[model samples]
Target chain A: MKYVLSFNLNGLPVDTLVKATDTLLDVLREKLNVVSPKRGCDNGDCGACTVLVNGEPVRACLTIGLTVAGKNVQTVEGLQQDGKLHPLQRAFHEHYAAQCGFCTPGMLIAAKALLDKNPKPTREQIVEGISGNLCRCGTYVEVVEAIQAVAAGKYKE
Target chain B: MAEYVGQPVLRYDGIGHVTARTRYVDDIQLPGMLYIKVLTSPVHKGIIRHLDTSAAERMPGVAGVITAKDVPGKNAYGLIPDQPVFTPEHIRYKGERIAAVAAVDEDTAMEALEKIKLDIEEQEPVFDPFKAMEPGAPLVRPEGNVWEFNSGKTRKIRFGDVEKGFAEADVIVEGTYTTATNDHAPMEPQVSVAYIDETDRLAIYTVSQDLYFHLGMLTAIFNLPMNKIRYIGGTVGGGFGSKNDIHCDHVAGLMALKIRKPVKYRHTRREETAYTTKRGPWTFYFKDGVKKDGRIIARYVKTVHDTGGYAGMGPYVVDKNSILVAGPYAIPNVWVDGICVFTNKPPCSSMRGFGIINGTAADQLQTARVAEAIGKDPWEVHFINAWREGDLGATQFKVEAAGLIEAMKRAAELAGIELPAHLKAMSSRGR
Candidate 1:
């Protein structure tokens, strides 16, 4: 039996049937074709599948597709408004923060949640913010720098 | 040289993953694709005398059940081909591939896992590498180690005589360092999807670092020419070194060949950790001799690498690790040796930073000891003796663009982090 689900995703209203077993990650990946939220550990140990749920960071892999029935879901794709990339995204690019990039979408979404809550966070706060996401590349030094860059207005162009 | 070798540049792979547009192997779903699930031995070591797949073959949406008999020519494939695709006689490892079931849905393929039955004679397995090499150590492979000399337990890098140089030293320090096996734990686990293209040839998509290496192994395992196999590498979750081992991709391709339909195999997290491998545990011994003025006179290093269950990049990484174990120092004499040994642990291989991180951890910790004996600052000692751009490494060959010192100093200045006083206590005899 097909079920109907209506929700707003990345600023657009999406009405779709979410299989009871399917995860919000599956919908974002399969139905919406948004591939950024990678299916990492899938069990939620590694935060590669994080997204903005009600403007807060949540692990998409853990969320049942039906649970996000009528709520706001923001993915890495919706970070930028208009024709410009977000300041945080620009900082990541400038600071060489991302290597391997497998965990970037989750890192971006996680950082966005932190920034939205506290526009100006200390370096330590930024580290604690994205600590949920793991990078095998050992680029934590640069990742911290990139986030601080955004907070410092180093990304203002 | 490019204008930005050391300069910070955004990773090219960053844009796609950040934008949520990068495609992984499991991300692709073909129009008419089937999924495969393999049933591995529950026991550690056994002789598979029989296999019955009749019930599984008759299930709805079941394509076929493939075993060792299905593999045509060369029934084995690996960096070393001793590991058979399907075991006809004995199972080498725990999850030694015995049989696979292909069906219309993954759940069906998974559900049919219990249907396949096997007859086996269990044997006492040797999980320890050291004991395995001893007189009565039950031979894991029996025919010596799987990695031959080129891939075996030995590497050599020598310079001036070590004994004579050590004889001139006023102080000497030697210690062994051991690190546990850590998983690459790539966010995206291993997944493989194989299908027949318009030409009816196999097209395999997987997460891999080197596509050419995949082509070579797949060609051997599947008995298909390079043209028949098209391997596509997309945004791998994180290969580290696990995906580089062509196990998942090959298994998926063989199933597709037998079923003649598109086959998809995505490993669950548990399956990923169970089926794949991790970086090997290593034991490194470093001996350094230095003059009273804090100048290193000679160095000797012996690295023993536990290759875990199989030899992936163990031998190659050991060789590199041994050289790096020598440390960033100007020494008059050096002799470094490395061995890649097989163990029962999950197949060990490479991780981020390759051998450098592991090797540096051992050597840098040793150098501060040398600095202690001479009563000199570790930083001053490192700066004075650190290799310059054109300085020769252990070999006579010069190393260009060696930024060891510059990078270290610049990092210190930027972070306002001088060598922490606590690091000096690392080599102290008493706690």
Candidate 2:
């Protein structure tokens, strides 16, 4: 049995049919055609399917589709506004933080969630913020640097 | 010189990555595409007594079911062509593919897989390489468990007379080193999307590190000419030598041909960790003879690599490892014997640095032991025996453009270690 799921996605209203057992990741990728949140593990062990639900970081693979019925969900696609890249995106691109780009979407979303709460995070805080994400290419140092650059106001809008 | 030399240019695909526009293999979705799930062997070693897929084919939402007989051209495909696409009767390792089902969704396909009937008689399995090499060991294949090199069972490297060099040595150091198996565990799991294009050619979107290599193997598996298939790749989400083999492309291509629709086959994270090829375990036994003057006179290394189930790239990795197991030192007499043995586990293959990293690790430990036995600084021992421009390697390969001395000096400077004036004046151009 499928249910009509309505949610605010990337500042746009999205209505799609999803099963009661469908995960937010499945609905976003298969139904709504939002391919940013990757299906890496599907077990929440990997943070590749991370997204912001109600402005908080959560693993979309673990979140049920029906649970976020009226919540505002944000993906990497939502990081851009008015044809401009977000500061995190700009910093990641400029600092070469993404190698295979498999973990970039999750890392970016997690960083966004971190900086939104703490505008000027220390190095240790930045490490703690993106600890959920894992980069197979071992780009954690560069990712921290990119997040620090964003927090230091190097990539202002 | 190019104008961009030494320039800090951004990655070409950087923008697409950050903006979530890069399309990985899993991201490519076509209409009317069916999901694929495979039936694997549950036992480590077994002989299939019975296998029936009729019940699975009759399941609801099941589009098609393919077994070993459905493989048109060939059932065997690998770097050495020893592995089977679908195990026909004999199962060598756990998670070996027996059949696959294509359905409307992954759940339906998984359910269809449960409908398939399979009967197997489990056999005694060998997990240790040393035990597998014994005379009475259960064979992993029809052939023996040991890989046969062109010369013999071992990859032999003999440069000079080791007995004569060891006779003149003052101290002998021996050590045994072992390294565990490692998984690449790339962020994105193994995935493939296969469909017959409008031109009647089989097209596949893959995350393969070696496209042409897998394309050649896929043609043999599908029994089609090279021009009959279109292999699209180059958007890999971190391979790290794990994507060199044909993981899903062959199975997905076979199912697509059977069902006449686009099929997507992907390994779950559990599947990726449990069954995919890995960096095989290595055990190295090293014995070195060094003089009190910090010069290594003789070195002998015997290494055994556990290449589980099939000869994916084990022989090649062992050969590469044997040639470099003596390290970059300028030893006069070096003898290495590299053995590749098969066990009842997942087949081990390529990883980062092939097999040299394991060999280097063992050799460095042996070098440190040599230093401690002779009451000399490890750095002094390393600098005194470092390879020079005209030095001969273990396989008699001429050393060219050697820069070990300069590299060590720079490494020491960065590491904040002060070198003595005499040691700092050493150069790689000469001794």
Candidate 3:
């Protein structure tokens, strides 16, 4: 029932034995102590458990820990380089994007996935991209506006 | 006062969300902690005649099993304390807890859930608000007429004479609209971790907005002093009011105490949607009186909300929606009434926009219809009668947040228009 799995986590290689039924969320949170990717809904319906496996955003709660072998995974911690906040992090701060911050991790990962593919997304596209991620604060107006600003290269200036 | 007020500030937490570094309750991992799972009722209405927990207690890796009988101090705990912490008599909703199993690991706790047997009878439940409000319908709660009498803190507003205003109006419009329930869909379903820290106090970590509210509830349920419960609101996952003040935090505290170890509880998506409170699903009835001259004479709105099982802020939702029936129009005569009724469905209380979204949608939609009936364009009637900064509502409250005229004008302009024909005629008549 034990499987030795080795994968790069937040830019560092992590090798551990996990049960066949162990989820990537439990592995990262309980075993490795990289606790940013939360257990929002054990099912993938809520994007709160998103982390990058091979640079593509995936719900850690849905993935089995053993499936992460040999993949270069990334997390919120990897977004910052040497104590400097990521551009998205800075933008979110400047725009008052985080009210409660629980959805921030999953939203960030999803937004990062969108930006990685298309850095210049339209306002509509920004809304569509984040439709999977729901914010209860009704901050979508600010969230969408912030994303649009970042995509249009306005915030960069 | 002249400076820009509506200028958008980049939201404060936007980047923290996108960067994936936010800490939620489940994100906290205490050393040697345990996982807890509950055996909930399969039917919406049932009584726990006998709970056989021997199989679960004998299961390997099972630390302990706690049922409602085991709960010390307060056996009944709810937003109002009418419902028990664990229902011993009847299941009010589909997911009432019967027995809870705490294990050294989450897997074992889940396994123990399969071992519990609950015997009960299903009661014919009240499924609809409209029927539940009728005279012959089965009461959803034991307080037979509490719903009809209180209407769950319904809002009622009256101004001027509605009968005279309606009779003098050139056109009348009325219609019924309904909306469905929506989940806060917070990235985090409710998660709570509790344990006795090194200080020997019952320390708890939960994702919530009002830490003080949860702390008070914990104190009452645990019979422990306020200082005994240490709450660390690590990070809130988009509450949308789901985590505003959870009814489930007590479960976490109970599990940890029963097992005598740190315990964590998190709901799956199904549980999040079916059990935890949600918003939306409101039915609205709006009646309006308007003149052919493009002036609104009177407005009447009746909002009936589905509270969905528990209180869960349903009363507040009804009041909030009823209070907003006028929208932004200038109406000299207005009457707004609301009712919040309980049903067999899952609880839905607060969501984004509180009650304003439902009220606004109904108001705007009704205004649009009234304008059409009176030979006035929707935009013109809406723009001309929109409440201004100093204009008072029927409630005698001043709107200080906005310049309603500028907003209407700019919105009309963006949509590529100035004013409707009736308003144009009004302007020429004035000149």
lDDT leader: 2
What number of clashing residue pairs does each candidate have, in the order they appear? 2, 0, 20
Largest DockQ belongs to which candidate? 2
Better of 1 and 2 by lDDT: 2
Report the lDDT tens digits of candidate 2 across residue range B101-130: 999999999999999999999999999999
Q: Model 1 over residues B1-431: C-alpha lDDT tens digits?
A: 58899876566766665555667787788877888888877766667877898888988888888888788657765555556677777665687678889898777887777777778888777666656556765555656643455534468888898999889989888878887778767777788899888998888898877688768877887888888888888667667777767667877888888878888888888877776766777778888888877778889998777776566677777767866778776677999888777655556666766566888888887888777877988776676667766666786667666766667667667888676554332221111
Q: Give the number of colliding residue pairs in candidate 2.
A: 0
> How much does candidate 3 score in TM-score?
0.86
> Chain B TM per candidate, please?
0.88, 0.99, 0.90
Candidate 1 local Cα displacement, residue B332, angstroms: 3.4
Candidate 2 docking DockQ: 0.89
The full ranking of all candidates by DockQ, starting with the best, is 2, 3, 1
- The candidate that wins on TM-score is 2
Across residues B1-431, which tens digit of lDDT does each residue of candidate 3 receive? 44548776564445555565555676677877888887877887655677789999999999888888767668664455555677666677888778788888767898998988777877878877888788877667776523443533457788887778899998888988788777777766778888987887888887777788767777877888987788888466667677765656788788777667988887877777777777847889988888888888888888888887777677777777767777876688988888778877776667777677987887778888887888767777776777756666887887666566566666767888857554434321111
TM-score of each: 0.84, 0.99, 0.86
What fraction of the native alpha-carbon contacts across the interface, defined at 8 angstroms, is recovered by model 1?
0.67
Please estimate how well model 1 matches the true structure, expressed as its whole-model Cα lDDT: 0.77
Among all windows of 10 consecutive residues in model 1 chain A, the one with the lowest summed lDDT is A91-100
